[model samples]
Target chain A: MRVSLSEFRPPREGAAAPALRELRDEELIERVQQGQRRAFDEIVRRYKGRLNNFILRMVHDPLEAEELTQDTLIRVYVHADKYREIARFSTWVFTIATNLVRNRVRQRKRQPTWLSLNPAPEDDEVPLDPPDPRADPSRQVEREELGRLISHATSRIPEKYRVPFLLREVEQLSYEEIQRVTGLKLGTVRSRINRARARFRRHIKPLLRNEALLAELEQIEARLAAEEGSDSDD
Target chain B: MFCRRARSFISLALDGALPADRTITLTRHLEGCARCREYQTDLQLGRRLLATSAPALADGFEWRLQLRLNRTLQEAARAAASAWDAPPAGAGRWLRGAGLAAVGGLALAAAVGLFLLPGEWSVPAPREPGVPGALVERNAPQEPAPASAPQIAIVEAPATVTSTAGDPTRTSVSGQSRTTWFGREGTGRAVDLRLSGAPDPRGLLERQGWSGGSLEDLRSIATLRDQNRRLRDALAQAQREVILLRAQSDTARGGLAADAGGQREAPQTR
Candidate 1:
């Protein structure tokens, strides 16, 4: 028999089903453990995009990222009973995603490549979003180039350092949280992140010293300071 | 703070992980050192760029995931249902599962008995000299056997053979015939099997191997025995069902006949 997503919700709570979208990750997971299928759907909705983006950056292959993201969610669904409230839901989910990506990376290393009939573009060809019509064309171009450079630099970071680096910079996770997620000692997490930032700067060192960009940054800083001063006077 | 240590602290400060005093010192160092100020600005810019660099998610991602989850759930459900419907294993099946280890044990025992102590055992004497491959039982008259028959060298000690209700010919003692291929290494010599007073090794050595019979023969016998028991159970169930169906048919026919008789009498009385 075909199992629908709605099949798992307990009957008595169906009418009184609360707004799962409004609930926190931990609360939703608790509901999921109780077999509330909507809670699981909500969890999937919440993490699928973030997980996919994170995995894509790590693996540099969108198709593999999508597959890994699905696998991660499926793992969460199947092993929902194993989850405890000891850590944030995001940390646990990211840990699962990182492990899946690590395995994929290892397998890729072993086999490496095959003779393709056709030359394919790089796996991580950045899909640039449309530029704002009102924005300056030169500035938009600079932003796009900088974004591409940053993405390339981040991917260039050694996997050990890159993981904690991305967790800190992109996902904005704390060092302690990265430690928990990566199962690394706090010192290791801090050091890796430190090394990753230094490496990232070296990759874009030329851009950091570019006179035009530096001048623009100075202008923006001055503008921000002037706005703060005006606000203080008011 | 040294520039090297300041850079590390600057990275930590950006993440809000460095202590307040260290942050104060790093801020002061950045103010004094142009290189450190540039390093902090570059790091900030990199972090900002990385934040906005998230690639667009593939379309229909969630739809695809829903399909996978449904498939997974269905497979798990099917597995559980089949497990629930499966019949519990019976004694014959259990013996079949352990049939290999038992065969190995028997082979080891037979090898020990044949090589170690040949004189103490009573080797069955060939009573009929004319019969070539004829098997002669101890204390029983020998019957002539075909040349194609298996040759057995059996040493019997007081052993009890349990007879099954269905097949008397396949009793536990029939295990003797299966030992024929053990020693047929070109000399046409038969392997000598020693039977003790122990309870019959149930179908352990009863069946003949097809071609220089391997341990597979024992496993096949066990499997066949299990199939036989299952078939017998099915037959009994079919018989019980047939009886119940026949009784119901007879009752229905009796009611119809009574109704016909009453209608005929009503027409005559009218």
Candidate 2:
């Protein structure tokens, strides 16, 4: 059966058995060196999604993330000889992605073309429009307030700190690994993560006092619990 | 305690980099201090939320990447195959041909000199009678004989002349006729002499007139000279071949010695 790329989405929870069943990254790399097309395909199958998401978080553009991910894979193929077994394949792959992201950011700074594409302000800004009269007032108020808080908090954090923060808090990479990917010192990586959390907290504090943030949090927890139930059934 | 260093330590503790003992101490301190506790809790909560929200791999990204990688591998394989199949460059082919030609020319010259030259000398038929007879006739006086001279005169006169001289080897005929006979014999002898003459036979050939005898002598000299030159050239080529072969052999031997030494040293290293 042909397994499509879409079918390879990461399981939300860890699957120890599948991880064991898959070939080790180094073994896949060796196969690639020997001109095994399938091996390279397997490698791409293993890393592409994770890498794409990682790049997406950094660039915040799905198209650009996809392009950068493809570029990273191409680099891996071209410079396969340069890979050393000493470093984990994930580290090496992320290093390539990070470099590309950094270059894109630098290029944007110089050219400023990306400024126009800044994820439409409307997409980021919480709608100030009043709730529909027919809608339940409590539900509408909660949704509006939560949306406003998340947008304000996420948008206020500078891109530099936001990435490290997201990566640490959201992506869960260890400080050393983050250091490897970002070419930052361990100290700097931690500081960025800390600063990102502080910024997030400052933005959310005002909205959190309104009680809607707490209600939204409860709703998220309920959704997660439902997801857990379905996962358990599987 | 909440200094810059302490703040940095707090960040490190949040990242799970603090040693176990230090982490415990930091945790205890954070629990008691409201401000620090709030900071630590916020950081942890933010990190957890972000981790949960970080995007999962997009649909079909892995498959597309796989396809690209496969194409790349195939292209590299084809390139390698083509390179392996292509003919070697012109300089390599030319060098190989030149080396063969040089070795062949040397071997040919060596065979000709070693086998043919001595064989020519060992031949008895052409060397004895023709050479002696030609020498004797050349020494005799030159004289023109009548075209109608009888066959008996030639035979009987030599017998009579030998009897008169009292030595069968010594015989005299008419001066003019004898001169003509001697001239022909001398030319014939010269032809034979030129074949195995001195190192430089050209000097001897130059004295002879351009007649059939002289032409024969010149041709024999030319042939011998050519043979000598070929022999010398072949010897030189053989010498060069020997030197090259020796160097190659020595190199091979050296390599073998090195390999043997390496084998001998392996056990010691282990």
Best by DockQ: 1
lDDT of 1 at B23: 80
lDDT of 2 by residue, A1-234 (tens): 122233333232234344333679887887666655455556766676677656766666667878788989888866776788887777788778778888997897788463454563343222233333544656545544544445446767898887666556545667777788777887788788777767787776664455655566667557657766975575
Candidate number with greatest TM-score: 1
Q: What is the interface RMSD of each candidate, in Å?
A: 13.7, 24.4
**Per-residue accuracy of model 2 over B1-270 as CA lDDT, tens digit each:** 554455556777876677888777776776677877666666565554443343444444544554454445445434433432222356323423433343233333333333534553221213234343332322222323433211111111010010112221222233212111111111111000001111323333344322221113334434444545543343344345434643554564455557557877999999
TM-score of candidate 1 versus the correct structure, residues matched by position: 0.54
Please list the residue runs of candidate 2 whose C-alpha ends up more than 4 Å from where it truly belongs after superposition: A1-22, A34-42, A112-156, A159-163, A204-234, B3-7, B56-58, B62-270
Native contact fraction (fnat) of model 1? 0.36
DockQ, cand. 2:
0.10
lDDT of 1 at A53: 71
Each candidate structure's count of clashing pairs: 3, 18
lDDT per residue for candidate 1 within B86-122, as digits (tens), equals 3245632332223323322333343344454465322
How far does residue B122 in candidate 1 sit from its true spot (Å)? 21
**DockQ score of the complex predicted as candidate 1:** 0.14
Each candidate: fraction of true contacts kept? Answer: 0.36, 0.24
- Model 2 Cα displacement at A198 (Å)? 2.7
